[model samples]
Target chain A: MRRSAFRRSRGDAPFRLASTGAGVVLLAIMAAIGVFLVVKAIPALQANTSNFLTEKIWNPNAVEPAFGIGALAFGTVLSSFLALVIATPVAIGVALFISHYAPRRLAAVLGYVVDLLAAVPSVVYGLWGVVFLVPFMRGPSEFLNTYFAWIPIFGGDQVVGKSMLTASIVLAIMILPIIAAISREVFLQAPKTQEEAALALGATRWEMIRMSVLPFGRPGVISAAMLGLGRAMGETIAVALILPATFGISFEILGPNGNSIAANIANGFGEATAVGRGALIASGLVLFLITLVVNMAARLVIARRKEFARAA
Target chain B: MTTVQTGIQPISTGRRVKDRIVQMLVYLAFAIAVVPLLSVLWLVVKNGIGRFDLEFLTHSMRNIGARDAGGGAYHAIIGTLEQVLLASLIAVPIGLLTAVYLVEYGPGGRLARWISFFVDVMTGVPSVVSGLFVLAFWVLALGMPFSGFAGAMALSILMMPVVVRSAEEMLRLVPNDLREAAYALGVPKWRTIVKVVLPTAFTGILTGVMLAVARVAGETAPLLLTVFFTDSINNDPFNGPQMGLPLYVFDQAGRPTDTAIDRAWTGALTLILIVMLLNLVARLIAWWRSPAKRGS
Candidate 1:
């Protein structure tokens, strides 16, 4: 090796610099992306003070430049909420079954299947939703609306085929794999000795899980849910395929609530005018921050519980 | 006698009814989870199988609506291979080198700790965000036109973290005694790493690389922003639009015609098959190279 006269003495400084440099480069890239997005989006945000963050109008044909996020943000959160409510319980149960109850071979098969789902491309899921699934949701949506129309959230929507319900179901399908994988891992990591002690006391299988395993795993499951939430909030193609891009605030799960941050970005980005593109960038920045917060929150919840457990 | 029999039978019947309900629910849940997965696969096999003919696999994209209809995805397949292979080349070395640095040098130092921690943070970055980062840095700022190289760069960004983490674990498994023996023999650090340490962890490193490739192969967003698709094949990476299997799926599904929709299903299946093959190869390599299997 050629002698580096510069680092011949310390020998460690070069490697240290490289390592620290790599770390800084990674951080700098993330920070720079955030800053650039904000800087680029400033113009679009300036043009529409009232509509940029809150208004639901999205008509480019109008003489005035009319655009708003009220509908988009509502759609984003509602679909995510629907996905969370549906996936969380199923994920928890599947995790429980795999880690606690199922036969070893069966559990392995289940795990493989779920992980396989994660590998499915987003566009494929979207196609499946449009071609195979949305048509079926019509009957279900009507059935729910028939009895539960009195409830604001279940009220009838325009176009029974392409509604928030279709989008939400697709989102749920995508997030389930992630949530299940995390929860299964958490369940597996529950203090083995604690579980053994419960079983030794002749606690039935279900009761043992209820008492000893669950409390320790509660934080982990919550973290898993949060991760799933992050994914649901940002999922684009599947939602884009199914949702009608109607801009308004509607509580109905089966109704149009415009399009999500991601769906709107994907839908409008290709054809967007210069100002329109910047607005989409601004919206993208919002989505990015939301996901970042969700991720950090999940990490904090997991980290804090570990700290508390140690202290106790 | 009849009244007693009736009373006993009613109670048993109710208990059986409750048991059946629980059993049915369990099956329903399993079925619910499996339906989407299987139906998607079924669609792919049914539609994609016809498209998987030899000519289709080997040929380039045909012109639009000229009825030359049988050209293969050869260009796309070649592009995917080259990009992913290039990414693997970039990623494996850097990742393995960094991993070695951590394992060999770090006992409990601050620098090592930071590298380890930042890696975790990097792991949480969503794939789309990573795509945007590549776009901002490489395409927008550098004035590099979108190409296969850009897609490879994005893949490298995703591939690096996974490789670093997995290789670190693998390298750490090499016993300290091995290093001590090398030191006693007066072997230099770099020589010891190459001659003694790497041989032991080669299998694991290979596994990590294959998994990384599997991950990046199916990515759509990075390609969407960096190397957008072209209908006709361009073998060159530096100049023009290149197709990938994921992008093919996206293009087909986005249009939603009968023929296009069928093509999307086929592409999805093909992508899945490629991933499965890579995983299988990794597993086989790991098994074959394992010390116990070799009777080492």
Candidate 2:
């Protein structure tokens, strides 16, 4: 609003100071989290017998206390990447359908459905994944293994459902709504004049979208995918409930082997000792860093897009 | 070559076929997306409806065993409400003031940019990591006992960003003309915000706050470490461990027996219903408050 008279008043200083204090509280909280995690994680790192990054074993509670994040980090990256690969195209397609292809009423209903899917708690997804999806996925896992055995990741003899593939699928479902919602917003915001120009030419519907909408939404799609990737990497309850926890890092996605940092912490923390709790906190720091990098990268992408759009 | 020589050319068979195929693919994609959601809701309702009754809502699982039949989520319901209310009490004021600062005083300022960036980063922080932070700080370093208060603190960390972002959007939507009018009448900026700007954005702020509450109420990872999941009722959140619906569902689902699994499904159903109710109310309030704001 136009606050010319208010701006001329002398009382603006105190209000500004009060709001700045509130803003500083947020900064303080973020700083405290980083400092606390580092301070608490140091002693456990000092006590470790194995290399914290490269070793594959986790034994923080043992007398010797050998521990590493090799397997957990591997599984976290692998499943999250797989989830992004599976969810990105489908989410983009659904976003396109809702924004362009569907009729108005249907689009509204579908959008609400997607929002409801997002509202479902992670624990509920965990319950559904464990109760229904795990057993249901066995047949598909077996089929994939039987048909695609030439592929290394699908060649494992044990085609048990509770494997990396299963966890990735669950993560895909968990993240689909977020990607769809974000991209839908982006797609809906495409310039109408550009779409009309493409259509006023002799272009088909799909051609119009490709020429006008897709190019406009490219940066948005990237940031949305990154957001989904961040969530998949840090998701705790669903992956914990589904993936049969294992410490081995193998390429066989169909094999019964997987572990993520957040899942490991959630599964192991209840009965942990002092060092074990510290070790989990140390791993949590790693998780925080990964998420932070991903989120910052996404924001960088968005900020660059805004500069380009403004310049253009 | 013969078809597109003129300005108003006829549509070709090849182009028509491509359009049909792409349209079919889009429809197929939509169907594929909806399948998992439908199946999850169907299964929860199918399995949980049998146990979702008055007895289940009223009684507690105090004396129930793996084989026993009768139990309820009365204690968990109370615990979830108390913890969520406490967390909202802590988060809403800070979040609102920060948002007010961003919109009213520091739009595009250096500190505002930094604050907004960290808030976005905070939004992506995992629920379990927040739990770990609280465990490391409150329970471990400070030697505080595990209780619902600790869980509320962790949940506040998660809820504050949601409230800030949503409330910021709402505050930005308030018209500049209104503020200008107040200023023209010789009113101070703070009074204008308190008397005029806030009232205009109150319903929007309420919706945002309620949505944040819904989200944190369903968070189990934080409570797993903080509240620690008791079976019996604990009235005081400051003194003792408390039962929450999400934690109860997780604990029940971990059991090996069929009855326990059944209860887990029922608990999941209850949690979903609670979240759905809050979401519906939030949406309803938004819709009721702004009937003219459509589509966007």
Candidate 3:
């Protein structure tokens, strides 16, 4: 018995080592990324105060240079938030239809189509936005400018063309498929027993979804939003093509100009100095940190809700 | 009379109407969601179809071309394929092995938890950040020049997490009974995993790989950062300006020329076709192994 136990212990030794080795690798990758960003960002942060984060002007070439990512960050977050607001209700509703209400064949077709949209490249979206959506939105911007002109956000000097609103609209379209797909998966995973029980208890089809599907899918919906937020914040080609602002928080949502961190990086990276690269790295670090937090929160929501699902 | 009428009609009638409205609203929302999709597809087809031709596909793009005469997306097509394929070679093995370690070997251990966290972080990374990260390290830190190789490296960062997660899920789906059978026959842990669990999950694993490759193929940010998009062909992944389909669309669309715009539309259509092919392969592989799935 003792000899057999020793043999087994020997067998387990390599397993333990390999697993720990994998752990070290993950940590190493994370450390490498974290260290590089921090070290590179140091010079940029020193040259300008951390408050430069909020500074609106981005003249990298200026002696005693004035640079700040405030406008870009605001533009990114604002457009993403706007997109979330526009996409959420529609995503949840569509998900509910595909998961619970649609005929099986129709649901399959719908699911396949949404997946196709998800696979469409971001650059294509940029191209379409530039050619078709921008022109199409001119009329809508006119309408918004006419009716909601009193609202500060709607109160933009319309360049008689594309603006921040156009960017937000494009973002909304980009994130729609992500939100819808995740929510659809969540609704599909809702407890079959609970759904049947709801129906058995004289619940209507809608009522069953309201009670069972919504609760079950809450975490997944939040995760979906986090994923979409990450995409919106980090988006490049589409935002670059459409957002027209140089950089800064404008009160107008429909103005034909604005910029995001992603657009900033894409537009300036080629021309930027080491200092410029450092500033962009700082911006990237902040973006990375934000995404990490949001993802953790999303996963925590799912795991925490897991217990409740299992119990009910 | 109103009270009497309400009382006379079953309350179920009101409930039924409410259900029907909810159903209608759900369907309406889905329909509206499809508008952008169909509109974009329609526009791509309309504008892109005009640029499709044997010569247009075969020839390299020229900056001096006239509005009526189009060049080609040949260089970009080659660049996109080569960069993506190279990234796959780097990412897939490491990712698959890591996944095998997590599922079959690591289980719920501390190492598994860390791997899981990093994998999640990797998945949420914005494509722009991946490009920047690679730029920070490769261009700045290492003093390496920009090339398609750098683009491939950035793409691998994005591709790795998806492969690890998807491949892990498939590996987990392999029946435990198979592992036990191998063990009962005196098979080693590594051997059993390689022969039994892996073979069982091969189809699903292939599906994941296909999907990951397709997803990475469309990325514009990394290609923009690491490989300078040019009008002419460049074959070397390690040096010079390279053409890539997504970048082609970006560059040509930015130019004011009608001929460039036409080429950009064609590139977009071509990208869609490649993506569709990947999806089809993934589906076919997955369906073949799934008894519940019907052949398309």
TM-score of 3: 0.92
DockQ per model, Cα? 0.26, 0.68, 0.55
How accurate locally is residue A62 in candidate 3, as Cα lDDT from 0 to 100? 49
Q: Between 1 and 2, whose DockQ is larger?
A: 2
Off by over 4 Å in 2: A1-14, A305-312, B1-10, B291-296
Instruction: Specify the highest-DockQ model's number.
Output: 2
Clash total of candidate 1: 1
Cα lDDT of model 1 by residue, B119-199, tens digit: 554555656656565665676557788798888877777787788877887897788899889867766566677788889
In candidate 1, stretches whose alpha carbon ends up further than 4 angstroms from where it belongs are: A1-20, A46-51, A58-66, A157-159, A304-312, B1-31, B66-72, B106-114, B188-190, B287-296
lDDT of each: 0.73, 0.88, 0.80
lDDT of 3 by residue, A1-312 (tens): 644543364444575456456546655766677788788888877886437667887766445656887888788888888888888888888888788888988898888887677888999999999999888888878898899898887786664456877887788888888788878877888999999999888888988888998987787788788777777777889888877747667767877557888888777776777777788788788877777777667666655654322110
Real A-B contacts recovered, model 2? 0.67
- Candidate 2 clashing pairs, residues 3+ apart or interchain: A1-B176
Model 2 lDDT at residue A221? 86
Ranking by lDDT: 2, 3, 1
Candidate 2, residue B117: the lDDT equals 81
Instruction: Encode model 1's per-residue lDDT on A145-216: one tens digit a residue.
Output: 888888887876453867888888888888888787877777787889988998777555565677887887
Q: Score every model by TM-score.
A: 0.85, 0.95, 0.92
TM-score of 2: 0.95
